[model samples]
Every structure is written in structure tokens, then in C-alpha cells.
Target: MSVTLEKVDLSLKYTAYYKQVKEELFEGSSDILNAQRSKAFQSFVMQGIPTRKNENYKYTNLHPSFSPEFSFAHSKTEKEADLQEIFRCDVPQLNTTLAFVYNGWFSRKSSAIDQLPKGVILDSLESISKQQPELLSRYASLADPEEDPMVAMNTAFAKDGFFVYVPKGVVLENAIQIINLMEGSSDMFTTQRNYIYVEEGAKLQLLLCDHSENQNNYLSNSVTEVFVGSNAELEFYMLQNQHNKATNIHSVFVEQQRDSRVTTHTASLHGGLIRNNLKFILDGENCEANMYGMSFLDKKQHVDNFTQVIHAKPHCVSNQLYKNVLDEQSTGAFAGRIHVVRDAQKTNAFQRNNNLLLTDEATMQTKPQLIIDADDVKCSHGATVGQIDEEALFYLRARGLDEGKARLIMMNAFAHEVIQEIKLEPLRERIDELVDKRLKGELARCHDCSYGKDC
Candidate 1:
């Protein structure tokens, strides 16, 4: 029952879907936002889905999974089960304000988000358009698809995701957790568009998790744009844990102001084919940005991480570290770029990528790039791909430890650098447990759809 569409036909299908949403579902939206959507759709039509010929997407290919016949979710889907109980987090002592988005549409049926804080606003993108359209005009469609074709596609089809706003001088103690569940009776194409704005002197933390339900094959395209005002802080964490039949293309674009700080940690634990596009623009002086990512792949799964950090102002600092653990015949790729402009003097940037291969068949490709135009800037990058250290393994084995225990110890040490970056202690512990299970092969069964345990 697999249906594949040719390139030209897929383009026409997307164009038809855009008109249907604009005329029927997205009626009465603000003119400014509507104009933005129209321009985005035009760009998308001009540039169809990207292929391996594109330099940025050379390692990742999207042709094999392009199914235009799949349903495009322009409206809500009826809940098949009680998602509230099935998708709850098992980590103890962690308190968060939960929000749910099912099949690319925000779940208005859930009762978890009945109330919010005084200075904070959390609701569906459709409602925000009717109530606070002016607030979204700036951040919505901020990411241009001309530079990235996939982003343009998302912008063209974006209907609703989440809109979060934090007023100035307010701080939220607990984290805001968003759970995105994809479940349906057939193959479908889903898109999520999210906008987050933090005013000057505000602080917030967010945990974004993606989960797939059912055994159907689907495609998920999501985009998020964030603006951080001067003296504000934002901490973001993303967990990608989907079934093997699912393909996810996710992008995040962040703009930072003077004296602002932003940190993000992305963990790819389970999925079939996953790609993450992360961009950080340091537009003001004395800003700081940190990015950390880890992916554990096995059983022919593929994961790609593309990160770019641009230092446009003086006295800004940026650091990035990405690690990958590949087993069986799994494949992984990392392409990281750090650019410092001409006038950005006193800029400090550092990037590193480390990968571990458990078997000879597992493969990894890494490219760490640095482009500096300023004389006073400090920049460095390095990458290493290899197996476990023989000497270290022998050291542990000599102390009466079994071979399995010794290998697990070394693997833990290799991933500890990126895992330790998690600021929340409880969350860090939860990730540690999962990684431990991953290395021990207990989590290997997640690729099979029949395994119903919480992966």
C-alpha cells in the first residue's frame, strides 16, 4: 500500500493543499500574516523539495519518502485513545506545564493547560492569530525558505503549532513541556509552525518532545522561530523519539539581543530518518550561545545534525559540541559551521564533533567548518571518528571487570561530555538511564512497532 509521487506531481499537490487551507480553514486571518504565507508558498513552488544535489543536504536524501497521496492534516483528527495517560513522562519529581499537539494540530480537548501564569501566554497558533495577530507578525515566517528549501515548504503549509510569549521582568520557575504526538489511520504529511518571544529581562525554559504512535509511515516537517530580547535568557531541550517508520525534518532559528544567553540540547535516541537544522544569530554585543547534541543510532537508522552559529557583533562567545554513537549498520552525519564577520572583533567561537562506532559496518561522516573574517577573533574546530580506546578498555578489564562492563564504562565516558550539559538534574538522570540502556542493547527493540514500552 505504498504510494510514491514523482517530483513534479508532488509540487502540484502541495500547491493545491495551500489553496484549500487559505480558502477554507485559515479564513479571516490578518492581512499581514496572510501576505507572508502567500509569499512563502510562492517560494516553495519555485523550489520544490530538495535533493542530495544541494550542498547542505548532500548527506541526507528526501526522495525515497515523498508521498503526495498521503493526507495533509489541515484540520484536527479525532483522538484514537487517551493520549493524556499514554504519553505522560515517567521521570519522577519533575514538574512542568504540559501542552499537547496531535497530528500537527494543537489539542484543544486536553484539560492540562486550563490555566497559565500571569505574565505568560501559551495557546494554539490559530487562536493567537485571531486574538494577538500583531504579536506574531514579527516572528512568524522569520526563517526564509530561499536559503533552505525545506523551511520554505514548512512555511507554505504551516497552519498551527504553538505560540508562547513571556513579558519583560518575569521568570518562570517550572519548565514548559510540549508533547507532539503523531497518530492516524493512514500515511499523512504534518507540519508545525511555532513562534516564541521573550521580552527584555525575562527568563524561561522549554522541553520539546516528539513521539509517534501507530504503525503507519508518515512525514513530519516542523519549524520554530525564537527572539530573545536584551538581558533575557532561554534554555531549550529537544528529544526526538519516534518509531522507525517515521521521518522527521525539524528546524530551529534563534535571534539573540545584547547581553542575552541561549542554550540548546538535542537528543536523538530513536527514529528511522531524522534531520535537525539549527541556526543561531548573535546580532548584539556580549551575547552567548551554546549548543549540544547526541544521537545513538542502530539497526540501519539514519540521523543528521546541521548546525550554524553566526557571530555578527563584537564580544560574543559561542561553543558547540556534538557526539554520535552508531551501532550495527546505522549511519550518522554532522556538519557544523561557525562564522565570524569582519567587524566582529573579540569574538570567541569553538566547535567539536566526536563519533563512536560499535561495529565495522557502522558509518559516520563529519565536517567541522570555521570561517573567520575578523583578525581579533579566536576560533578552533576538530573532529575524531574511531572505536573504543583499547588501552582504556584494557585498563578497566585488568581490574577484574568483565568485557561488557568495561566497554560500557568507556562508552559512558565518551558520551558524558555532551550529557553533562543538561542543566536540570532530574532530566539529566533520565537521559543517563536511557543512554545506559541504549549501550546495553536494551533499547534496541524500539525500532519494532510491536514493542509497547515507553522508549
Candidate 2:
């Protein structure tokens, strides 16, 4: 059966809210800028909204979230104390932080920038658009949504976001962390956009955390673009720990030049329904890309991760590994595609996805594809869907280990491969804690089952 796209039913209140944003576009704004905004608005209206039929969104059903009209929220009732409480509950350390409060507002008071090195630019989208329009035009023009509808939507409605630019030969001494807090109490639709540029020979590390308050049933549409110049290196980490009532559509686009290296680690812990699109293009020779993801879902949470790695130049390498653990009636999906162009000889690409289902009702769909047009290339793809190893569990049990402890150990071990990829010690430990917490919760609900084999 084909799913249908229903237009959102907006109330009179939200209708005025939409008109407000439209008015803000040209409110005392320059004619040239107003014209660009008008063009983008027209494009957005032409595209309308994305639906399940879109190949990238086939596995993720978003109609339920999009059908309801939402207003654009500008503020939240959250105070510093409230934000602090949230930080303590979700993430503890609070070291090296960049924050996007409410929807797209950057909070300098709640963030730390002491560790950033010289020549690194971390500013809001508004400031960048006014101060560095050339850079914005360069990268924004390169953002094409024909491959992913979410990208198109984000660009069309990008009002606020973070921008990072690293000058050539500058190696940041610390990791850049971005925390996005979405409070759904307000009746608004939130959209954010970001542009990141790593100049030649520069090095960078970034962490992105998405969280929301108790309020649920909100929509977050976000897009990020990263450009890595020759000999540059970048490490990116994304964590989704929002309320289960929130719907999220996120996209990340990366372009790598000669001898550059880019690594991305994604962890999706909580969300009502999430659709993630990650794309990497190697445009120069000797470029390298690595992608890793880990997701834990419970209850009715649904998560989908789609990744594409394109080899447009010769002698490029790309590797991907994604693992997921689902409990209750949750669902997880992983779709990875690797493309090697005709002239991209000596391309080395590998992709793998592993899923662990703890309940009979839990479901996972994994698809790995490799399209090679070159003869001299090394490419492989694989996927596995299963539960814990019974024999391994039995051996642990025979060693006098309790069933719960044994299960936790095995689950941790299953997630260790991806966790080990995190080079930052503090971040790695934080991820470990989250993994353990999830496993403990799973163990508490588990009934009589030998290594989850019977389920």
C-alpha cells in the first residue's frame, strides 16, 4: 500500500504565525536580500512537503508528524536553572559546549568557547550571512536537495543556525560541541541550518547533541553542510536524545578534497520518529571517509538512517559501520549506498550494518548496496539482523555470572566496536554510560529467555 501525503491543517492562530515569518523576510531588509528570500520561498512552495514515496524517506513514515500544522516558535520558558537541570539529567560533564537554545538561537551564556583556537570561526547564521555572504553563497549554492528532500526544505526555511570555519593550517586543540535543545511547549515548527568549512591542512572535531523537554509532538527540521579542503581532517559526532514525542528530520552533507579525512559518529537514543540523511562526496584523490552510528530504541520510537558515499575521484577510501538495538515495539532502519564512478579507479569502500532485536515485535530493515563502474576497485557490503549469541551467553552463565549481568556485558561488547571509534576519552565514557543505562533497562524488562534466542 502506498502512503498518502496530507496537507497540514493549520489553525487561524498558526496562519498568522506563518505570515509573520514571511513579513520578517523583507522587514526593512535590502531589496537584493528580499529578492533572494522571495525566490527561496517560492522554491519551498513549489516543492511543497516530502512524503513516504521519496526514496530517502521510504522507510520513515513522517505524515503523522507533518500533517499537523505548527507555528514558528521564538522563545521558551526555560531558564538557566532549567537548562542546568536538563544538562545534569541528559549530559553531565558540561565541558566544551556550543548550544542552540529553543529552536535556532545560539546561547553564549550556556556554552564554553575557551578551548577554541585562533582562526576558528563560530558564529550564528545571521551574522555569517551578513558578514560573509560570499562564503554563504559558495556553500549554499552547492547544497542541492534533488538527492534528499529534507535538505531542500531546510535551505528554503533557514532562519537561524551555527556556522564554523577553520582557517588553513590551524589545528583545534579541543572538540567543538553543539547542543540543540528543542522545547515543544510552544506551538511552532522549528528549522535550523549550519555551514562548516575546514580549510586546507586544518583539523577539527565537533559534537552535536539534540534534546527536548517534557513537551512532545513537535517537529525539528535541520541541515548541516561541511566542506573539507585538501589535507584537512574533521571528526563529527551527533547524539539524539530528544523527547519521544518529537519528530526529527536531519541531513548532513560533506564534500572532501584531496588527501582529506572525515569521520562521523551518530548515536540516536530517543525520538518519536526520526529520519536522518547523511551524504559524503569525495571530490579529490586520496580522500578518506569513515561513518559510524549506534542507535538504541524503546517503546514506539522509530528511527531511520540513510547514508550515501560517492567516489568521484580516483584512489578514495570510504568505510561505514552502523549498529542498532531495538526493544519493545520500536523499529530501526539502515540504508547505505556506495557509488564508485567510472574513472574512480583504486577506490576502496566497505559498508556493514548490524541490528539486535530484543523483542519479537521489534523490527529492523537493513540494506547495503555498492554500485561500481570501475574495474580496479575494492568494494563490499554486508548486513545482519539477530539477537545475542546463546552459546556465548551460556559460557558466561557457566562462569557464575548472573543472567542480567551476562546480557549487559554481551550488549556492551556488541556496541564496543562503534564506541571504540570515539577518540575523545570523555565523550567515549559518556557514550559508555548511555549504553549501559539502555542495557540495564532492557534487562529489567526481559523475562525467561536464553540469550534472547527464544524471542
Candidate 3:
């Protein structure tokens, strides 16, 4: 039987919320856009919220973290100076930046687009919808909410967000960093939608960072849709660091054309509860995609990384590698799914998930699945969950290295596989720093737990 949203209560809530927001925000918009949003919202309302029973969300529960109601208000405060301060504190050396300040207002001052080449359009979605309505209408139509409820929520309450368009044959030299910042007093529900279109033979890099400061009971539901044309190449990265009291749901949808290449990397450092949905549809021949993710959870933090790669054409290739480090009472979930459609001959796809448990109380669930409808396709998936290697540790100690230092070295080596895949120097350095800090702290914790000796 086909799964539908009518069987869930959260689906009802999503439907109700979509209706209210549709009337308030999207009523007078273009009829075509409204119809698309309506269909997506209806799909969300019918499917309801994902739960453990859902194969895609078997390891992560969405009910408890998403129960709070979010308001649909463009609440911009007078403290622009204060909010600006928070943005600069994160990555001061970042040259090309795009800031999306929701629950306050979008700002152009904080963004650096002076060096962007001609034929490349980088602006807010709100402005694009007004100035270039046709492009917005065409690209916005690509989002499908029935397949993803969080995406539907973002569309129904779509506010301000960054938009990028690369004209045919254009190659961007520098990376574009899109940062979403949310801060407020009342219970805030901020929804931002972004659309990126890379024309034929165009190449670009996009970095997305989600963050908030001192916001209690805040919800950030974001959706980003990308279109990669023939022979185009695009690299996308996401970094999420939010307050412990906040909740985040981030969704990314990409459609790749013939001979296109796409790469995505996601790093989750801290959050109260976080869920990421990364999906890609290889709709053309000879398309390639690579997805990598790493998450570090500590102190009761929860994180879920869900990825799906669909091979709809022949001669397509996809590779996914995800790693998680759990400490204290934290929990981590990794679910990677690969679907090969019929007639998608000679497809090559591989997915792997590895987890490292730093504490006895830390928990993790990993499920990697492959659904093959084509007989000629080669696809495989594997998952492993284990603690530190005791034999390896003893060997390192026997080599005259202190136990604590030995453990840190092994931990870094364990995570180096995914870290080495990062092509950008700035991002790689930042990730190295975060990983080093976590490893040091974990080593200290282990020393304290042990009786004056490293384990």
C-alpha cells in the first residue's frame, strides 16, 4: 500500500498551518505559484510528520522536537547593531558572504558580493520574486512538499532568503556563503527559501551556515532547491551551529541534468535537536554526485542526517560517506538511501555510515539501504557502529606514545577520511579546529572518568 499523510496527526497540524499561512502570505501571489504551494501543503498535511515507523526517519523522532507552535510574523527589531555583531563573530575572514536575517529583516550591508562576476545574480528571494518573476516562478515550481513536509512548511511560510543564478557558461571564482541568522524574544518560527540555478557549463560553490543567538524555543525551517544544467558543476556545504534550546529542520533538493556534477558536505557541531534532509535526483545521463557529512554530539544533543540519491538515468554515479561521534548522553542517527530506477543501466552507487561512541551512555542508530529496480546497476550500502579500538590503543601505547595522546591521534585518524574530502581550505581548517577541540575535550573527560590513567 502507498503511504499517505492521512494516517498521522502531525499531518493534520501541517495542513492547518499551511492553510492559515497561505491565506496570510501567499494568497495574492501568482496563481501558478499559489497552486504549487497548495499542492505541496496538501501533501504535507496528508503525510503528517515523520516518526520512527517511517523508514526514512526510523532512527530520529520528530514529534517531541516539533510540537511547539511557531508564529508567522516578520518581526524585525531595532537592534541591527547587536545582530550584526553576532554575524561577524562566527567567520570573520570569510570574503564572499550572504546573510539572511529572519525574524528581523534581510540585510545587504552584511553581504559581500562586490567581486561576483557578470551574468551571476545573487540577491534575496523576495527581490527576485518581484524583479524577475518569471525565473522565480520557474525555479520555485521545482519544490515538492508531498515528498518532504519540512520543505512544504518552508514554502507555505516562505519569507526572505538568498537566491543565486549563474548564466550559461559562467564560472564563479570564489565561494558564496549564505548565512541564516535568527534571534528574537517571542517563540519564533522562521522559514527561509532559496533557489539556485546553474546554467549549462557553469560552475559555482555555495556555503550555507545556519545559526542563532540567545533564542529560546525558536524553530528554523529552511529549504534550498538547486538546478544543475548540462555539463555544470556545483559544490554545496552546510554548517549548523545553533543554541541548545533551539530546533532546526533543514531540507535540500537538487535536480541534476546530463553530464552534471554536484557535491555536498554537511557538518553539525551543536544543537538541541537537528534534522537534515538531503536529496538529489539524477535526471540525466552521466551525472555524478557525492555527499559527505560529519556530526559531533555531546551533552544530550540530538542530530539526524538523512540522505537520498535517486538514479533516474543510465550511467549515473553517486557516493556517500557519513561519520558521527557521540559523547555523554547524546544521540546520533544516520540514514542513507539509494534508489535506482528501472532502465537506469550501468549505474554505480555506494553508501557507507560509520559511528564512533565516546561514552558508554552515548547512543547511535545507522541504517543504509539500497533499492535497485535495474538489474545491470551496481549498488551497495554498509553501516558500522563501535567504540574505540582497544587493540589499536594498546599498540599505540606500546609505541612509546602516551595513552591520552594516542587516543586523540586515533580519533582524528578515524574522522580524517571525511575531512580529507573537503576541497576548500578555509572550511577544512575550520572543521579541523572543531574536531581538534572535541577530541581534546573527550580525552580530558576520559582521563577524569578513569582512575588517574588514560583508558
Model 2 error, position 238 (Å)? 0.6
Find the 10 residues in a row with the least total lDDT in model 1: 443-452
The Cα error of candidate 2 at residue 80, in Å, is: 6.5
**Candidates 1 and 3: which is better by TM-score?**
1
- After superposition on all C-alphas, the RMSD of every candidate to the true structure, in Å, is 3.2, 5.8, 5.9
Encode model 1's per-residue lDDT on 95-174: one tens digit a residue: 88888888998776752565667969877887787687888775535588888878888876777888888888788888
How much lDDT does each candidate structure score?
0.83, 0.75, 0.75
Between candidates 1 and 3, the one scoring higher on lDDT is 1
**Per-residue lDDT over 1-455 for candidate 2, one digit per residue giving the tens place of the 0 to 100 score:** 22331243322233334456766544543342344554454455444465555566678877677656576653323345534334532334535545545466555555554446766788676666776777666644445754445555565456667888899999887677777776554545677877889999999888888766556467888888899999999999888876567888888889999999999999887778888889999999999999999888898999999999999999999999999988899998999999999999999999999999988999999888788999999999989999989899999999999998998899889999999999777788878877788668632211121221211
**lDDT digits (tens) for residues 151-236 of candidate 3:** 76666667556778998999887778766666666667777777889989999888876666554577777788899999999998
Clashing pairs in 3: 5-46, 5-47, 11-48
Clashing pairs in 1: none
**Model 1 ranges with Cα > 4 A deviation:** 1-25, 28-33, 78-82, 138-141, 444-455
Q: Distance (Å) between predicted and true CA of 287, model 1?
A: 0.7
Which 10 consecutive positions of candidate 3 have the poorest summed lDDT? 446-455
